[model samples]
Target: MFALLFSITIEAKEIEEVVVVGAYVAEDIAEPTEDNILETIQPTKTFMLGGFNGIQLSGTDTKHTGVFKNGVPVNDPSSGWYDFGHDLSTGQKVTVITGANSVRFGSGSMAGVVLLEDNFGRSLFTQIAEDETKAMVEYDYFQIAYYKGTQGSVKSTNTENDWYENKTFKAGYDIFNIELIDYYYEYDTCYDSNFAVSDDCSVEGEKLNVSIDHDRFTLGYTNNKSTHNTGYDMESDRTYADITLVDMLGHELGISGQKETYGERERETYSAYYIWSNDNVSVGYRYEEDEHIVRLGLENDGLRFSVGNSYRLPNLYEQFGDSWVSANPDLLPEQGYGAEIGNDWVSLYYYEFSEGIDFDMNSYSYVNTGSYISKGIRFQNEISLDKGSLFVYSEFTDSDKLRVPDYRTKVSYKYLGFNVEYLGEFDKGADFDGREIDDVNTFNISFSWYPDFATEIKIEVEDLLDNKYEFIPDYNSGGRRLKLSFNTIL
Candidate 1:
């Protein structure tokens, strides 16, 4: 059985950005490949500004369904790993939908699906404050960051030893009416030396949002923690509330609820959605219930669909202790049912092509009767180069053995800015233990110069001609590199 269909369409005049459901939203999708480019989009691995409301998607692998903010279901619950780049900041906006459209966000979507939108409208330091409730408490903002990177042979006899480090901190506040968020993250890695891994994460939260002009409402709580070095320590504490009603007759309604505790394992969820629009066309429906869980979804613009059924009653490392990292204590609590479909389109004018392009294509399929199933295809193209822009993307997946071909071509001919890329993974028809393996390639090249004000600097020389490839199976992924970055914005 072989089903592979590829398509591409382009029409550009881009300018659509401001749709932060849980944070990052930018129009025109597709451009990634560096071993599946953070596994096929969904915030391209991570970026964030606010925390939770409605809209949620998560995946990395190991079938564990996620999505729900006011109704609490951001997963992890012990090795489900929905890390979404650990609380993104810096003008946050993220949207990723990888591998099988993640069944539109229900039932572990098999290594893909991430949608985070949290930008809570209007900012520029709240337009100079002094008015809208004191500019929401003196326009608050905070950030702390640290990053370090290194890869292979820096010349010490070549057996290859890698390195990576990241530390982040962010804080936000909107006083008087209350809105606060705090985040912390830590990741450390060292490969080829056999074993060295560390991941630490934290999130603390509060929200009581309310807006009156177009109508809005919110209530929230989140306290989450993850610690792992292999010993794995997981904790989740949740509480939630949400309400949204917008009417001019065109209608829009949303309601939410949540309560979760992991340690002893406890659960609860509730959801509701409704919509009607005016423009071209729009429609929506959503329903959710909790205890054992149930969900239903439908939407229209191009299309969006959803269906869910769940029954998971056993947790706390699956009925108590003996954690060798976890699982199997009579393990059973993964019941299922799933569905999702999607399509999107935008064109201002297109007949032959003059000099404008923005196109997107997405396809997804999923099935789970006992446990796992997935199917995926994604394509995207964007071109507009006078100052900066050129992107191409392609993705294909069935499940796991992961093969990706990614290319990003960029040019800015003045002040010398150029980029050429080819990201790897090609196992053709893979099989293990029975033999058939040989097809791997990885490549990258980059150059930049911005020589002027607002403090700009760039120097990147990655994998220029060193390719030893093997992205996740005895490790050893790409080599030879030099990167330097500097930016200033106030």
Candidate 2:
């Protein structure tokens, strides 16, 4: 079930012209909206290998995707996974909705579900790029943020050196909402020491998250107590709930649950749902894995369609393992079926999987693999010229053992203050680390100006061909980086 079903927040403003399942809308705030996002996650049947990003839709190898905030269910129950590289959520919105029990915030999305909304009307944000430094503040109901970063190997790749830190706090009233987050990550990776992953590695980690929402319900707690100077040493705790049981005739119902505990294990209960939705359709039932689903979508004359079926299980750190990673509690729960059709430009999809769940980066385990299929096509366009705007996106894939690309493009333009970009990866069949690639291009240029209406300043230039595209094999892909920033509304 290598899935990708990420948005439907309030029927996405009454089905904004549907895309057979929409997403890729980062409205209203800051950055990190994709730049090696598990290999550029812009929908199109994603299947990025290594370093986390999963939902076994096809050649899928794990990380059963399911992310939500402002709707609860935020992965990481020790390792259910969700690491958009420290998830920089500033107006975070990325959508995708492929079906068949794709999502309703239950059963960890079984290979899909991404929704993160923070509703920021702006009130102070700062960024001083290059090596990373950020700040954020919002008053009238509290909000605070800070981030620090260091990446790749400033000391050498095989010599490894990575770093990270993040902190956040939030509060709101009227319908209640509360959140807290903290994390520190440090890593020293290795693999391709000619195969045999894991050779003198070091990892340090810690995380804390607490959430509360209302108007019905959603509560969460996560604490991955850690200290692994060499590997495998973690303490965990995860508890989550989603509730809202009312609204009869017109539908709308809900229920969810989760539980966790690490080490000497034994308290792993995760999955329990019963949901029903309205405006289109969505049905769910999980009652601890006896799973069931029904999903529907529509938009006639202008076209748009969808089909569903999916299921995923196998997390408890992929069945009892983490750190140096390795496990498989008889694993088995990746099932699939899909269909999609598009309109707003183009769209097409296909998925098929059975007892699949790969992820054997050379013995890092988690297999239950076999029978996989993936198909894709996506095209997007937006040309709102008057003064600015001209977006174009692309995707193409065919999957089996997975690592696809027959075309993957992205283009951007913004006029009046510049901002031109382009990305390319054509005919790749194995580039996400299966090796064998052909072209990998990227170009970026930025300029923002704006001195008034709140304030602004910007400058950027990334990889204009500093060529060194490594999407996670031995790290260090920071070929050419330069950034400068300033933002406003304070």
Candidate 2 residue lDDT tens string, 235-350: 77777776667646645565667677776664545444444544444454555567665555554566656565666666676677854677778888777666666676777777
Alpha carbon lDDT of residue 234, candidate 1?
A: 55
The lDDT for every candidate, in the order shown, is 0.35, 0.57
CA displacement after TM-score superposition, residue 423 of candidate 2 (Å): 6.4
Query: What ranges in model 1 sit over 4 Å off?
Result: 1-32, 35-82, 85-232, 235-259, 265-276, 280-490
Displacement of the residue 44 alpha carbon in candidate 2, Å: 13
Cα lDDT tens digits, model 1, 110-210, are 23344432323222211111110001111233344333333432222344433333344333333112123233322223222234532222223222221
**RMSD of each candidate relative to the true structure:** 24.3, 22.2
Q: What is the lDDT of residue 227 in candidate 1?
A: 48
Question: What's the lDDT for candidate 2?
Answer: 0.57
